[model samples]
Target: MNDNSKVLVALLAGVAAGAALGILFAPERGTETRDKLNDALKNLGDTIKDRAAEEIDNLSSLKEKIVENIKTTLGAAEDAADQAKTSATEPA
Candidate 1:
């Protein structure tokens, strides 16, 4: 996989290991540990969702810029073509 994927995998593995260790050494009861795990998972999920949304917004913005560039290039080409046609049809 790519570097980003590798890093993400490593980070997830580290988080899992750390959580396991924390649970093992926790001073609280099972219910408290479970609650903590649940909260951690919910937070992780929210973070991933936010990142995805941000990436989507960035991609959308890039797409709009590309489209605007294409339109401007096409308009320039059309203008040039019109000028060439007018010159060709007129006296030298």
Candidate 2:
């Protein structure tokens, strides 16, 4: 993975850890604390899923752009080669 992806994963992990610890330490009933923790975990899971989808879309877009550039470059090269061939065959 890239640096940005690594950083995002690290940040999310830290946030999850911090939230779990904070909830565990709060002076509340056990059931309430457990419920809060469960909600926090669900939220984190949703966030990760959303980020994964976004990353997949970004990668797909990048792949398309790269393919287009390669096709354009190949076409230009072929055109140049054809022009050279025509010029070489023509009479002076």
Candidate 3:
């Protein structure tokens, strides 16, 4: 996985731990607590989705850069082969 993936995982783990602790220490009755937790979860889910979209964009850009570099290197190699072939076939 990439750096963004690692960071995202760590952030999600921290949020889950914090949510668990909030539930353990909550002061309200069942329904109220459930409602509050549900709201919090919805908000957190939205934030997570936004961050995940950004990470996906970063990953896509990284992939493009890698592919471009490969193409450039391959082109250089092909040119070198063509030069070598021409030298071999020409008069000394």
The TM-score, computed over Cα atoms with residue i paired to residue i, of candidate 3 is: 0.73
Q: Please tell me which model should have the higher lDDT, number 2 or number 3.
A: 2
lDDT of 2 at 16: 99
What digit string (tens of lDDT, one per residue) describes model 2 on residues 1-92? 99999999999999999999999999999999999999999999999999999999999999999999999999999999999999999999
TM-score of every candidate: 0.78, 0.88, 0.73
Where is model 2 more than 4 Å wrong at Cα? none
Candidate 3's C-alpha runs over 4 A off are 2-11, 20-25
lDDT of 3 at 89: 100
Task: Give the backbone clash total of model 1.
Answer: 0
All candidates' lDDT scores?
Answer: 0.83, 0.99, 0.86
- Candidate closest to the true structure, highest lDDT: 2
Q: Supply candidate 1's per-residue lDDT for 71.
A: 100
Which runs in model 1 stand beyond 4 Å of their true positions? 1-13
Task: Estimate the lDDT of model 1.
Answer: 0.83
Error of 2 at 20 (Å): 0.5
> Positional deviation of 16 in candidate 1, in angstroms?
4.9
Q: After superposition, how far is residue 67 of candidate 3 from its true place, in Å?
A: 0.5
Model 2: what TM-score? 0.88
